[model samples]
Target chain A: MKKLSETKEKRSNLSKRIWADRQLYFMLIPFLLFYVIFVYKPMWGLQVAFKDYNIFKGMSGSPWVGFENFKTIFGNPYFFRILRNTLLISTYSLIFSFPMPIILALLLNEVRIRKFKSLVQTCTYLPYFISTVVVAGMVTSFLAPSTGMVNLILAKLGFEKIYFLSKPEYFRTIFITQGIWQNAGYSSIVYIAALGGIDMELYDAAMVDGCGRWKQTLHVTLPGLLPTIVTLFIISVGNILNVGYEKIILLYQPATYETADVISTYVYRLGVEQANYGVSTAMGLFNSVVGFVFVYAANKISNKINGMGLW
Target chain B: MTMRTRGEKIFGIFNAILLTAIAMVCIYPFIYILAVSLSDAKSVNMGAVWLLPKGINLNSYSQIVHKEGIWTAYLNSFFYMFMGTAVSMALTTLGAYALSKKRLVGHRFLNLFVVFTMWFNAGMIPMYLNFKNMGMLDNRWAIIFGFAINTYNFVILRTYFANVPQALEEAAKIDGASDFKVLLKIYLPLAVPSLATVALFYAVERWNSYFWPMILLKSDSKIPLQVVLKKMVVDMSSRMDSLNYGRDMTGTSEDGFIYSTMVIAMIPMLILYPFIQRYFVKGVMVGSVKG
Candidate 1:
């Protein structure tokens, strides 16, 4: 009977030891508080997707509409167009813009002059801090077509001036170019840091083996940068619907809506401009699902290829 | 080390010219706006302003300072930036610290739940409705409350926590230090670089936020600098006939005032930049790879 009592005491002691450290648990309190109060609490309102949500009616009192909102958004012909634009722009951006910073990082890594490299980096990154309002301003000012400097230069070269912003044909070019200009330098910093972490001993061995700069870069630097690149790629894929509607809203006029209108801008209109909460939430949920699938798939592929995943 | 080859030297020269040209193109608009803002209104109207100003004047800046409601806008922005960034940093650090522990039960679930919110969101109307329900509408906390701690920053903060040597936390543990004590006293002090980077990130994001402010803030007085900038750029084109820059009440053309307002909009960012400029790229890099 005494031995059994001792065993029970020992078992409780073992269970207590296995429990999460109290101090660690204490540190997590504020974290849980924040998410619960803000995030998880707000998540309850997500039920509004199934309800006809009116401000005065409130979430609780709002009548359940079932799949009506989703049906409404899905039934609209404009839905496919916005989805197509979102997918197309994100796909192109991933293909073209994703590789640019990698190339820029490679070029920067090869630059022997530290001053020049830093200067180039600073120059490239300058545009990012320029507000979207200002960037759009610059885009219009630079691509004015008639009196603009770009057109003037093009005219000097004996080519017809292109009304880039006003025309649907030139919309993607302007968007992608501005995006590359704004992001390339800022994006390359991660790759540069990754390159920095490459062990010096590895480089020294490659040198002893008589590998030149190009060979060293291919064999040593590129391999080291792979994980960082994969991570960034996964993140970018995660934001598949993040077409950054602010710039598009500021820049796009009715003439270029065919190319310029994305899921976010559409949401802004259906939500803010038109005041359709249910449709907007449904649309937002749709975008979220697509974005989630991409991130999930991207992580899976990355893990398969290189043993690197978001997890 | 071998010297750059003859072809390499030429390539370097070509790269230098290309980069410089791109830099000038990137940088010159702000300079142009600056010169345009400083130039005499007549010079600006005729597009006479060049790389250098025709005249140097603080008329635009002073006029904005003197305007009836402009000070309110400045105050609104300041209140938002100062309180918003501080709260964000604190919440992010504490939350991230807690989540970074592998031993913490439910860590994986917590992570999945948080990261899920990043991609999926309730759209603007739902969010607005959500805010109104919570009594955040027209409140300064509306902006602050909605995004006090970004998940991306939380991830970076968690990564920094993961990086602290386990043995160090254990030693502190052996000394009978509580979790909060070790986090506040030991971990935070050691993680200055990450903390600074995250703080800068939040500060910049909060400062640059326009859409939320435009949505949640109904009063013009509550609008931030970006909102004002948007008005000057977009609404100004439509409302150009309403403004006159000088005493004649017709003294300056709409173009002159528009350019002046554009330049005025840039001043805050420029002023606030030097303080956090060094950390800007480093912050992005950390948030990108590790986040």
Candidate 2:
């Protein structure tokens, strides 16, 4: 009886505190309403993925389809192709683009002159600010077969001009290289900050042990950076399926769809252009489910291993 | 400079050369584009312009300035950037201020509610359908309210707000100041640096936004600068008729026109970048560290 009364008193106290801060509650209403309408509402609307949506009938009036949309998407040949392209592109980016920043950071850390170091950092970081549209524009112009600077250089070296953007095989390479060029410097900032936090005494001890510059880097710098590197890597892995389609849409043509088409772009084409809302939503739901699994698994594993997760 | 081994000396020289090369590689494309835009149409067509203009001319810039569509797009982008950033800052500030208070009822739950949106969403198609159903299609509000408050920016500002000295708030409370007044008189003033950083971020994001604007706005006049530039540079053939530059001007070549448009689109960012570059790095670090 005494325990029950104590609990009742605590509940009343909570309500009284809430009443005291009523203005704060008023301040929160707009944000709460925004999330309900914009974020959660669409999440609820995702049920149309399993329905036969009709334009006139609306979301509520759409007929239940019971996995038909998912079945159609799975059976379509384009499904596996785009899926493979997304994975390959993401993997290529992970492999080729991820390490450039660390290497750049290490190299920059080696520089002794402060002014030169800042200059290099600023120059390399500038590209990250350029708009994707402009970047894609520059890429197309530089790789244009007949008049592009790249082709011009190749011709002077006595090689046949290859249409870099048009060729399917070159698509992944171009994307990854551009990804590295655009982000490697900016991404290095985190690693560079990490490098600054390493103990000077550790380097001194390594020097006393007759370690060379490379050895010191290998033993001291790499280990110092390991936690940060692993944390960022796991985060990247969590986003494996979310290779942005904006750059792809800008850079790709119909001829290059074989290699460049990812799930996002495919969904955009179907849902927005072709107006196949049901199938497009189904594919998107599938991508989200897989992405959630990846993120959850990555977070769990990183937490177990390093005590650092994106939580 | 004091007692370095031969290996260290060699490494320094190599590092300097490599960094210089990397810097050049980063800046060369901008130079090339500027050169092409300034060169004569015939020179650009023959690919004679390499790193510098050949027979310098302002014909391409003049042509772009004369185009009605580009100006409309430019005006639309400015409106979106300013209006969107204002709404975003207002919403984010109010939300962050409320959530920053540990004593606020259900603050933990509200924080989690906002943060959860970052991890999962309805994805693209469902969102499109939702917006379409709401009659936001071809509407600027679709772009504006579609991304009113980035959850990451919310978290950054909340973190900053949380760090404001508790004594400051307590003193204001002792003086019988209301929560809104405390926020206005104390917190907002103290958090100007962070607010400016986040505002710049929102501004740049709105300026560069294309995909959402492309999907949301159907009419050519309502499209933002990035989308307009894409139409000109990438889908050149399809949009050429819509451009209506006339057959006479077309004889001079469209390459110069495209390059000039790109340069124009890039000008705002390049101009603002140096002044805000320091804050950009700092803001990104704040997000990364706390994120």
The TM-scores of all predictions, comma-separated, are 0.87, 0.96
Off by over 4 Å in 2: A1-5, B237-252
lDDT digits (tens) for residues A137-161 of candidate 1: 6676556544344765677799986
Q: Write the per-residue lDDT of candidate 1 for residues B195-225, one digit (tens) a residue.
A: 8888777776776777888878887867887
Clashes in model 2: which pairs? none
lDDT of candidate 2 over A84-171, digit per residue (tens): 9999999989998999999999999999889999999989998988889988889887877667788778878999876677779999
lDDT of 2 at B22: 94
Q: List the residue pairs that clash in candidate 1.
A: none
lDDT of 2 by residue, B1-291 (tens): 236789888998999999999998988899999999999988876768888999999998998889899989989989899999998998889899999999987888888899988888999888888788899999998888888889988888988999898999999989999888999999999999899889988988899888889888999878999999887767653333243221222444588888898898888888888866778777877787644
Question: lDDT value for candidate 2?
Answer: 0.87
TM-scores of chain A across the candidates, in order, are: 0.85, 0.97
Q: Model 1: runs farther than 4 Å from truth? A: A1-30, A141-164, A199-227, B103-105, B166-177, B237-277, B288-291
